[model samples]
Target: MPESFPAQTSAEAAAEPTVLARIEGVVGRLTLNRPRAINALDLQMTGLLDDALDAWEHDDAVQVVVLDGAGERGLCAGGDVRSLYDRIVAGHPDETAVFFRAEYALNARLAEYPKPIVALADGITMGGGIGLASHAAIRVVTERSKLAMPETRIGFTPDVGGTWLLAHAPGHLGEYLGVTGTTMDAADAVFCGFADHLVPSDRLDALRAALAAGGDPEATVRGFAQAPGASTVEAARAWVDETFSADTLAEVEERLRAHTDPAASRALQTMGQLAPTGMAVTFEAVRRARALPDLRAALAQEYGLVMWFGRTQPDLVEGIRAQLVDKDRDPHWSPASLDDVDPATITGAFSDEPAVPLWD
Candidate 1:
């Protein structure tokens, strides 16, 4: 169960017309309104959410913030990666840098928020979406939830403080998930510490209403929460810990190939589809992040890696083109295989000229 917040007297609700903000009694409600795109976040939405959080930080009328998506598909799919692709291809690196800077800052703030934040992650929450919900005080998911940090498939390292979360997940499961871009269900999410409660999708509205009416949000969610059954990750815990525990990607691959489990076979198949260099970098990044002191430090390191990827890597562009723009599901990654990726190149991505500092 998540920690509860103190209740406060109801105040007249304030209407925020843009992006669906309304103060319901003492609970401040904010919705990601871009349903057509599964609420994939953009620069404008990130700024709006950051501004609202800043405003509500000290607003007595807003005792707790309830965040959700406007549509049924999910809370959010991710950041507007297509936009970043376009900007990068257009030689507008500054625009891409600005978006990442602001988005990462927002992620850091959520990690440190003083007030309790309740996020309803009922559907496809991946990448940037994880950034929004994973750091909250109360993260609610449903059986319908599908969560992942699948940046490796797009030739990107999992950003938005992903390395921080992945590094701290139990055992070496983080490496398996990060490198393979595995999508976990509700049970897996809770097992991995990515969510707090498992409320049924149908009960989300009632839960939201209870929160808005100044009822204890944590209690309401707990009341509706149900056991998520068994987690596949938990079932394969031993295999994951043993296979991914290898210090090098080569050793991990060797373990996977030698294992006869169906899961190992499936993981090996998935790895074949991802960008090899990206996977190598992701492995090193997560390994390094495990020793970092805090979320801010992890985000800073990710920013540096992403900027470096943009400047030197061709896989990101090729991966996005094949997966998104071309819809072909066939990315011809440069450096073709993990064995072809230079260890020095992977290290350089981590040590690239530092990005503009994320904080003072």
Candidate 2:
């Protein structure tokens, strides 16, 4: 077990340490240690990370920071949405609001960190995971990497700076993957700009050791990034761009329905399984991010949407039940049809009424 630090407050002990921090050989490493929960960033983890990053920014000895996961399955599956849902059901919606405000602020800080940030995206990285990885200057991926922003599948649009990163993806690929929750390997991730380096999993320990030994971490990472690779996902670029070019989900669906390609058929099926409201919101968010001038503004906008979502929607709880609790692969979305999800509902999610401060 990792050595425990003195608890900041009695309430902190009631929850698990969301993150594990250590400094060795001029490298500051932060591991998302909640393995059983797939290293999801909960409230405590977000606060801990924010403090760690702020400290490291001023510590001259720490030349580089590496973010990794504790377990074999993933770096982070997503944020702890189930916890937020529980808070809502317990009639503490404000707790959910607190969670996003801190989480988004952390995302922004990482994006602008002065010191070099390297992310070891060895396995599953999605939703909140993308927020942590995409902002880093160097993102290393292994063959096991399975990266995505699968929020639409769970009745929520993507948060955690997903709006900005997804918008930065090549062409319409972002729209295709965001709506479909498509998972990709290291090669695909590198192609999509989510990863900068592709290292074999077996080589990670050696890489970490080299960094610890005062090796030029940035140079070492770049060498791996330039290693031989092919863009497998890029081959389907034309189809992805054309099919997702429609103005709305219905138009996109209509085009997909008309296409004869097997890939198009699969895309249609994936969309069919996701919540209509979630998909619509995701589509809009990505487009809006593309036009936004700054990352902070984009994250603030996401916080606005998430604040209302955690309190008002049952999709998050149902999604957690289907994906995590029971693993039943079935979710009963409240507004089952797209028609039931009116423009007003999506508009309401973007309100600034409950003015949440960006950082505490």
Give the number of the best model, judged by TM-score. Answer: 1
Give candidate 2's error at residue 245 in angstroms: 0.8
**Cα misplacement distance, residue 81 of candidate 2 (Å):** 1.2
Q: What is the TM-score of each candidate against the true structure?
A: 0.93, 0.90
lDDT of each: 0.84, 0.78
Taking every candidate in turn, the Cα RMSD to the unseen true structure, in Å, is 6.6, 4.5
Badly placed stretches (over 4 Å) of model 2 are 1-18, 226-228
Off by over 4 Å in 1: 1-18
lDDT of 2 by residue, 1-360 (tens): 001112234454356566888897888989988776567777788888988998899998898998999889889887767666678778887777777777787888888999888899888888888888888888899888888888877777888888787788899887887788787778888888888888888888877777777767889776555463776568778888888888877888888888888899999988888888788888878888898888898887777777666667788677766765566879888788665778877766666455556654
